[model samples]
Target: MKRNTNYYIRKAHRYLGLFLGIQFLFWTLGGLYFSWSDIDKIHGEHLVMEKKDFSTTSGLIAPDSILIKINSRQPLTPIAKIELVETLGEPYYQLQLMTGEYRLFSAKTGHLKPQFTKDEVIEIARTYITFEAEVKETELLTIVSNHHEYRERHLPVWAIAFDYEGDPVVYVDAVTGQFERIRHNSWRVFDWLWMMHTMDYETRDNFGNWLLKAFSILGLITVLSGFLLFGVSYNKREFKFLKIKKS
Candidate 1:
């Protein structure tokens, strides 16, 4: 019975190790990277420009002017919030409707500026960065390209790539003219590692997938079998030592 149990334990341990060893190594390496990597750097905070507070001083355009312009164009929706924001030193009135629609108007002229053109997006990208460089390329993404990084963000974004050292890319909301996120080489590598660690290829965030569960069970079996074999070996050696001492 002992020999039969040992045989089964050895077989299970060896096969489980063969099947899940590389994944174990990946989990360790990815975990170490996540633990040591600076979360701010991973978010590419160092590549983008900081937001400057909008001035609330006099000479600013009145809120009524913006409301009049918007109400004249279309039927009124219940307003949730209205605020003044500046991009590239130009002031604009951002209106949020309770229906989840956003509108932007030029605070100076009260003209409706719904969407940003490619030139305007490039200018915004340049203003968002501290360094001086023309936009290298601009691609309009109708849908989120990578769901892992840009999950839950609004669609129809502008991917503006810069000709900087790390080849930084900024994703801006085309409709709202908001800076969605910044991505670079480090972020890409970190994202790939995260996907591997989570083992969720489709979403890259689900941790309770079947593959992970199966592997976890196999890993537990491997560890328990190893401990059982160690205990068995220790007992056999001690039995032999006792017999020798008695003789």
Candidate 2:
């Protein structure tokens, strides 16, 4: 009966090890990659230029006059947010309405301009990227999936792909006309490994998913069973020693 129970324990241990090995391997590999990879490079920090300060605060149009003109032009449009933003190193007033509308008004003249165009964005990208690389592709990104690299950022961005190594792509907000983020080969690998680490295939950000929870509980049980197996084997050795003495 004792040896029979030992066989069953060993069998369970073997199966459990096999069950958890792949995921544990992923966790280990993800840890190594995350620790060894340079975070700045993964984020494509080297490809971007530092943003210029919101140009000289002085000598700009009066805010009250701009507000009056805006109210007269588009009356009853409730604004959710407003800020002093810049496009192409020139100051502008960005208005975000509660209904998800974006408008840019020149800070100097207070005249509302049309939204960004791809042609206009090329000029911005030329000045934004640090290295001398030609633009490969220019896309207007309006929608994204849950696992998208540009998830949670402002929508309707200009995705400017460059010919630089690592195949870097820079995103600029189409409405705000501001640089958003950079994605590259290194970042893609990091993102994939991150999804594995978090075990959130849908969103890649959720830490408390059902699959991860189940694995964690099973992992704990496996650890406890290991201790139990160790104790059982130790007792078996003692029992065999006593039986030998009697014989």
- The digit string of per-residue lDDT tens for model 1 on 1-247 reads 9988878878888888898899899899899998999999888888777887876445667998768766878866889998888876778888888987787778888877868878888878777777776678999887665554566677677889888877788888887788889888888888888888988887887899998888888889889989988887788899999999999
Q: Which stretches of candidate 2 lie over 4 Å from their true place?
A: 235-247
Model 2: residue 174 alpha-carbon error in angstroms: 1.1
Model 1 spans > 4 angstroms off:
55-57, 145-149, 238-247
Model 2: per-residue lDDT, tens digit, 1-247?
A: 9888888888887788789989989999999999999999888888788877776777788767888988887783788887887788788988888988787889899887776899888788877788888889999988998888889888889998889888888888888787789899999999999999999999898999999999888888778878878888997789999999999
Per TM-score, the best of the predicted structures is 2
Global CA lDDT computed for model 2 = 0.86
Give lDDT: candidate 1, residue 63.
Answer: 91
Please report, in order, the local distance difference test score of every candidate based on alpha carbons.
0.81, 0.86
Q: Which model scores highest in lDDT?
A: 2
Residue pairs that clash (backbone atoms under 3 angstroms), model 2 = none
